[model samples]
Target: WKSLIRVVVSGAAGMISNHLLFKLASGEVFGPDQPIALRLLGSERSYQALEGVAMELEDSLYPLLREVSIGVNPYDVFEDAEWALLVGAKPRGPGMERAALLDINGQIFAEQGKALNAVASRSVKVMVVGNPCNTNALICLKNAPNIPAKNFHALTRLDENRAKCQLALKAGVFYDKVSNVTIWGNHSTTQVPDFVNAKINGVPVKKVITDTKWLEQEFTERVQKRGGVLIQKWGRSSAASTAVSIVDGIRSLITPTPEGDWFSSGVYTNGNPYGIAEDIVFSMPCRSKGDGDYELVKDVVIDDFLRERLKKTEAELIAEKRCVAHLTGE
Candidate 1:
């Protein structure tokens, strides 16, 4: 246990929360011995449902869980928390207009951001997992002016892991053997998954595959549409892995990456590293832990082909930020 750690999970009774709570209770996400005090934040409408879930968590007798509480107010839950996982938002239901959805979530995140800035611990770390995650994260970061920009991030490790799995299957290599793969820019269909520097047994993937056209048609499309495929197959949105990716994202933030190998995360970029937009959250390679924080694993070269995809993803993120700015008057 690394002392008492306060974790506030917004949307804590939702689908992703159902999966995440057990993980946190079991200490799989954080350390096994670390005692946790969970403050769940949800809307007034969902308060009773969240309370039921919290009761179940308590009955489960999780050794590391020191306490659990459900709150309808964001300010009540945000106080003195070391970690805040922003998972709740207005999801993009079928036929919902994109602008309307963004506006709704932008409003939610903006309020939470202000609450966090006002109350959370000075060293709080935040991860926004809602749709339009990068922009939602940016809205929160911007609203929370007191928090460091570097502390806010969006979730994109799921995309990165999906890319790694696809590459491993295509290359006939163990998933562990594949290293240095990077997912650049937004967490959308336009995301750039770079294979130029990826290696299988230390051999460059580009040299081994030698099929640029195949890569363009098969690999890229598969990586981009993975979430859609899963949703179609299961007849529901992605849940378990959404929680798993949340774990992976936090682990990559606190645990050091091994030598010559790194994981991907949606993090703030300075643009020089990967030409990603400065002052905005975008998925990029990172390594970190303890008192130290995530730093971009830059120096991976981007050819013209990769550059185009990166630009497309960045454009989407930029437009999203603009939309939020317009909505919030920031």
Candidate 2:
């Protein structure tokens, strides 16, 4: 029998987690041979909703789902968990400033990070999916001094995926044909999609597409604003795609990255070789060794355009860190 791995997912009752929990339960993440106990954590307002979610999970009868637990307290849900999906955070509503959103979610993530530090396995790998994810991850990592900062990651595969798909469609090739698309700096709108490094079917994207205008202007803007465009069209933020990206981020951390290809993930930059300054969570190309460990893809060429965008996103994350400085205990 495969050893049971406990996975904790916060915001278990939220729209995105609703999709993620089922995927995790079915072994889409850890493999079907791996039995898993899923713990769902929510806040007081969503505790009852979490119960309903648990019931639905029970009805799903997922073969790999050895157990299911739900709670309003992170202390309970985070106990000895080996993997944590920090998915729940307050969404930015009308008139809500970015700083305000970070401040509100800061308290929640602070408590969660402490809880994880208290009870989670020393090897726990955390993937932050909540908005302002890069900084929220920084907050969580700061509070959990026991956990290696490298074990914490923020989701940026979504932007990378968007970039690849855009290139694939324009090139009339399969999505998988486009590879090595790196999303740098942040998960927010200022994210820099490094098209210069991307490849389609082993051919340089620039040669295949031949539309320097689109690559330089349209494609980057679209990838950066993809989430906002989704919200504008759906009247809500992305759920399924976001959930898929969460799974992608987690799987990437646990599965060895393929040769010659790397994925985008936001990671700590305390000693990064990338020109990004230390002491903040920054997104960059990364490769995993299938042990919940990743190495940043070093020596990536950053042109003037990519450099300016990376700097812009870095400033935003630094500002967010300042916004929640009081909560992080840093």
Deviation of model 2 at 316, angstroms:
1.3
Model 2 regions lying over 4 Å from their true place? none
Model 1 clash number: 3
lDDT tens digits, residues 1-330, model 2? 788999999999999998999999988888979999999988898889999999999999998998999887888889999999999999888899888999888888898899999999999999998878888899899989999998999888888888988998888999989988899888888789999888998877889999999998999998989888998899998899888988888888889999988999999998888678787888888998888899988767777877788899899888888899998876
The Cα error of candidate 1 at residue 70, in Å, is 0.6
Predicted model with the maximum lDDT: 2
Give the Å error, residue 109, model 1: 0.4
Overall local distance difference test of candidate 2: 0.89
lDDT scores of the candidates, listed in order = 0.84, 0.89
